[model samples]
Target chain A: MSEAPAVRLVEVHKAYRRGAQRVPVLAGITFDIAAGEFLALMGPSGSGKSTLLNLIAGIDQADSGDVIVAGENLARLPERLLADWRATHVGFIFQFYNLMPVLTAYENVQLPLLLTDLPRRERRAHVEHALSLVGLADRMSHYPNELSGGQQQRVAIARALITDPPLIVADEPTGDLDRESAADVLHMMQALNRELGKTIIMVTHDQRAADHAHSIMRLDKGVLWSNPDDAAAVQPAGQG
Target chain B: MRAVPLAYSLRNLWTRRLTTVLTAGGMALVVFVFAAVLMLDQGLKDTLVATGAVDNAVLIRRGSGTEIQSGIERAQIGIVEAQPQVALGAGGTALASREVVVLIGLAKRGAPDSVANVVVRGVGAVGLSLRPQLRITEGREFRPGSDEIIVAHNIRRRFEGADLGQTLSFGGRSWRIVGLFDAGGSGFDSEVWGDADQFMQAFRRNGYSALVVKLNDPEAFDAFLLGIESDPRLTVEAKREPVFYADQSQAMSTFLTVLGLALSIIFSVGAVIGAMITMYAAVAARVGEIGTLRALGFRAGGVLLAFLLESLLLSLVGAAVGLAAASLLQTYTVSTMNFQSFSELAFGFRLTTAIVLKTLAFSLVMGLAGGLLPALRAARMNIVEALRAA
Candidate 1:
């Protein structure tokens, strides 16, 4: 694990336009996750956890302040460069698996590598290793619809790991999965962080899901708290 | 930037097989109409152009545009045939045919009540020799000054009282149909031939319609044409035989081309709209897929190209189908009134390589027009909003 943080947010702020209204999602957010840390963000609905994760992944821009990920300030990069930067630095996992229904498991995993200059034979080898790491080596030819939800998420994990990116951001990765499937996915994610020393940031509302990470942060009304009890102290009784 | 694979576009189109087929079918129908029109125009021009030999010169009245409207007196025919450039035949006679062209109304083979105008050509002794491609397909040639007529192969099958051994009552006289001659798909295949003197007397005509002269050297045509037009005693003009026949088809060919193209334009609009609708639907259905692709680091240009490629492939499939159907039209012959000659001319549809290239290019244009807007819409979608569509 490195002493320097893998991701740093310096007073980052973000907002969305709803007609003429400027609705702020995240305000004055500042945080850091060490190189080998597994941090989970817990928040209520509409609390900007996903927005913060998007900022760190370089998929969205900050309205003000800076978002630095993988030693580069993401807020300063242009959209074209940001996409390329994401391809090399950040892997994303969505709640719904987000696998292309038309492509098989191997092809879905091989999608990111297509952006690189990797040869076909080498791409096949990387895809094979990634799918095997997720324990779906035999299901490489199966499409998303043919696989169970847990299996599909495993395929997405293989896709995320195919490029061997430094940081992985998952937004409610196990939100749609059953208990057993969620446990399996969380265990896989933990192994990726511990064994490969990769930085991981997860956004989830479930405390049990957040428990898999090294530390947890709670967000409420565009503000962050290191302790869940500190955030709960400000909430009215029975409001959650 | 890495482009989406061609297989991806192909597979996506295959996934929506019904929409792809329906859209492509519309484009194919438009292509069929476009190609068929070109073939009809080519067929009309080819039939008339094949009627005359390039080495032969045709002499008609100075102001006449067609043989049917031309009048050349017997004295003028002799003066025109006596030119030094006229080719010599076997017995040292000038190779010229003083022909009388007249139109006669005859009943069609199946409908006796339906009468159509048919051309009757009275050729001199060397007329058959001049047209080397003319072959007596069924019987022998007509005897001179015997009221015996040789019906063209196309004329015999199309008109009544024009078959072999049949007698046609016209020109206040009975004429015997002695033979059926095929003119190798030339305009001559629509005319009946008899001796010039007998036709002149039977039709009460004082002069010939035109004089066809074979030149000794085809290269001497320019000087020969100059001499004939400059002659003070002659009221005739000379043109290369092939040029004369080709001019005969110009008006009718232009009419068919204009009409066919107008129809194709109207139909292509509908097909292009159909393709647009199909592509729009594809984009709407695949919004989530597009977002996922973007998230995987594909540029907007890649997404746009993929959709456009799918549309182009669909249109090409339609073009191939339409062209196959249009090619079959080559086997059947059609007859219509020639605007220039005012007589029914039979010609089959002719397909050429130029027409194939034109049709494919036209289909590609329709594809590009229909695919552009939808592809732009797909490419311009907001990534976060698009992912939420899933």
Candidate 2:
């Protein structure tokens, strides 16, 4: 523990209710994701993979546990202050690559920095650099609808990294791309982790997508199994 | 408070042009009615105020609100004229005019039997000197103590027998319309002028309705008023001419304002409901975007402010359009009945700078009121559910 873990979840528990019946999604899940580690989470549907990612990203609160990220305990933070913390500490990439349809790629990449005190000219420079990192510099002015599915995901990646947060959590980053486009997106993400020293947590059902990460874990019935072999075995073949 | 870029709100409004236009159109109609009401009241006040002078004073019987309802007897007239504060003419005569105001039924030019009450004032010798604006635009002034009459342009144009060179028969006597005069297109343009003695003799009356006097030193008005009102021999009230004229229009103008305000309140209810519905639809349609914004670290307050800004923008567009439509009324001249005197009064539609500012402020209130709950709904959205919606 020379360098503290980027994310530490201690005995986190969460549940949902469907028509008066309580359904537990995560139960006492404990783990530490070291700084600069790129980890992939593998799980079946409804196995709390996405819920655990949300907890780490500060998008949702754990029912009862210490869900901490980047030295900040999100469980104790108010929603208002947690938003500021997330803006400075974590970047979120959704499964669908949720870029605002009305805003162009450049504007979308600049979204996170808008919450910061960065001057407009500095914001422009940061947006340009982030888009260039994602290989989307030429597509800066193109809106989401004008771009291909893979290009839109690249824009989403640029948006996630523009803040230069210590942690990036992506939920199914390439679940909807072609094999070649998925490879390109995964390579870009690996570059972000290796070159920039970013800690990444990815959730996916695709084995090839998970193979790009440095470490792997699986979630089953609200419990975490950290064996990389168990994670690899859960992945079905012929899937990206 | 940190705000979303105004462009975001502007672009959202542009994206849903149809709803924006429809909601803003309803607001425009409400603001139009509101502005027009204020203009109508302002126009009425202007017309009446223009007929009076700052240095002149009008005397009416105590407890009478207007000249039409007041009577100053022949004896009281001498007492009022003998006051030393009255200005003098070159002939050493006092600049005082004994006036009688009476309402008579007069037919319009086209419809002879459909009559409306018109104001006809009888003036003593110095009447023409006191009103510098009144001019004999067409013919000679009326000779005092004769059956001769001079008609104002509005009365001559709108009434049948009040025309030049015609005789108007009323009170069992016939009066010759000798001249047509103009009173600078003021409230007096709706009145007819004739000899006070002849008018009183024909109507079997001996008292003047009011006395109009010019003060030698305008600063001596208080002393003059005191001299006239405090006399034991006279039961009269005196007011500076402009003040008296403003008082005359107060009741009528207030009624117009109240009536317009009530209607605007009713229409604003509909406009507010329309704006609320439009905002609710905007929130419902952008559920995914809302969640995306939340995930991007935007606080709920930012989301709330963005929606409210959009609503405010919609209402402002409506306000501009409404004010533009109301401005067209400036070219129109309208007539309504004066409640105090029961006579037809004509005035034009008017607008002022203060009125424009007030109208815009009113629209902002409506925007804030209508957008509150819908914006709160958007801000309170659970991020997980919203992202899952689309």
Candidate 3:
């Protein structure tokens, strides 16, 4: 609690264009994610939970207001610098795993390291370390399609962790898995948070999936409720 | 920034083997034609230029662009030989030859009905000394003042009645072929040679086409040229033989080069279009991949460079294949009509370092031109929107 938060957002807003019409997605949002804390963002469909995660990951820019990640003001940073900042500071996990089908699991995990100035031998050691952490070290040469859904997600998680970034933002980390596979992914993510002490902010629609996090925040109709206790936990308040 | 690993692009092309081969094949065809055209142009120029001896000078009538159109009287020949710059032979005779060039119709050996113009040069033993590259391959030289001619070794294959010991009639006289000579693939290899005085009497001509003379000193060409041009008694022009042959080849070579380039330019458009369509499809299919790459911190410039390199690899593969195919033509020869002399000229495709470099530059341009827009689109894609697409 004494340390500065790993992520801070000041009145963040974003919108989309629906055929020349402005459709608001996130409106005036503010939040802070403490270092080494696992935070989950819960929202109904079309609630802009994924967009908020994108803003935190620096993959998309906010329409208005400031987004600060790992002590860097992202909204003020130009796009050219943001990519370098993201490479050094944050990692991204997607809903479908998004592993390149053409690359082996080892190659997919090595993609981020390719942007670094590390020597090839050092990169190989780092890639092996990350892949082992995900327990897919033996599947290093298998492509995405050749692995099961849970295994593919593990490969993607290995890719996200390969750069050893302090912050990890995962969008629907278990969305494409079956119940068993989803449990496996959730358990691995919890281990990543508790054992490795990573700061994680994940977007999910399933409360059971959100329960793995130490803290839960909710979004609805472009608004944020920072405390899960503010509304009854069993009610599923924002379900469409 | 470090280059994206070549293996990445190589693997992508391999993953889409069908499109890769099709696009690269199209590029290869264009580059093939481009290289072949350059080779043809070089070959024609080389053959013509080889006929000229650097230390020798050629004299033609003023305003006559070629020897075929020039005329020098006996008095003019005597005046040119008397110049001190003219080299003396072993017997103290001036190393100069009064030559007459005339074109005679000859039937092609394969297609007897198809006729081509062949040059017939009337020369003496002095003319033989002027061009040391000329060698009698078979039989003997034509005797002076006799109805005798010698066919060039190459000319004998293409024309009728051009073999050793054969007879041909033209210009109100019949001349027997006494020998066959080789001119080391020079333009002279396409001509027939006989006695100049006998040729003049047979054709009823009073003037020679040109006077070819060797310089007494290597650097005496300037004096030789000045002596001929400064003479008030003669209205004639003289030039070093290399310059003369180069001038003769300029117009025909230029026309061929321009025509070949225009065709290649037109062909390259279709090739570039094929590459564009393939690259656009690649971008479309890899939308999710591109988004992931952007999310992984590859700058837009990096993405653009990666795609451009992919396209360039495809085109270069094609160019290599095309150049290999073009080099095969270097072994065989083709005959074309030299517009300067109105005679058939035989030459082989000649590959030079300059042509190779030019073809490579040309293929790279096609790749850059084709891949640029598609690469821009890939670079500019919104990461959120791209990742959102299925």
Number of the predicted model whose DockQ against the real structure is largest: 3
Best by TM-score: 3
Chain B fold agreement for model 2, TM-score = 0.94
Candidate 3 lDDT by residue in tens digits, A37-70: 8888888999988888999999899999888888
Worst 10 residues of 3 chain B by lDDT: B1-10
Interface RMSD of the candidates, in order = 1.2, 1.2, 1.4
Chain B TM-score against the true chain B, each candidate: 0.97, 0.94, 0.97
Stronger candidate by TM-score (1 vs 2): 2
Q: What is the overall TM-score of model 1 with all chains considered together?
A: 0.93
Pull out the clashing pairs in model 1. none
Ranking by TM-score: 3, 2, 1
- 1 versus 3: better lDDT goes to: 1
Residue ranges of candidate 3 with Cα displaced over 4 Å? A226-240
Off by over 4 Å in 1: A1-4, A228-240
State the lDDT of candidate 3 residue by residue for B221-325, as single tens digits. 887778777889988899888789888989888998999999999999999999999999999999998898888888888888989988999899889999999
DockQ of each: 0.50, 0.61, 0.66
TM, chain A, every candidate: 0.94, 0.94, 0.92
Q: Write down the DockQ of candidate 1.
A: 0.50
Model 1 / residue A104 / CA error / Å? 2.5
Per-residue alpha-carbon lDDT of candidate 1 for residues B1-390, written as tens digits (9 for 90 to 100): 777777778978888899999999999999999999999999988898899898999999989988889899888888888888999898889999989998888899999999988899999999999999799988799998889999998888888878899999879999998899999999988989999889999999898999999999999899898889888999998999989999999998889999999999999999999999999999999898888787778888888998999889989999999999999999989988888889889998999999999999999999999999999998888777787787
TM-score (2 decimals) of chain A in model 2: 0.94
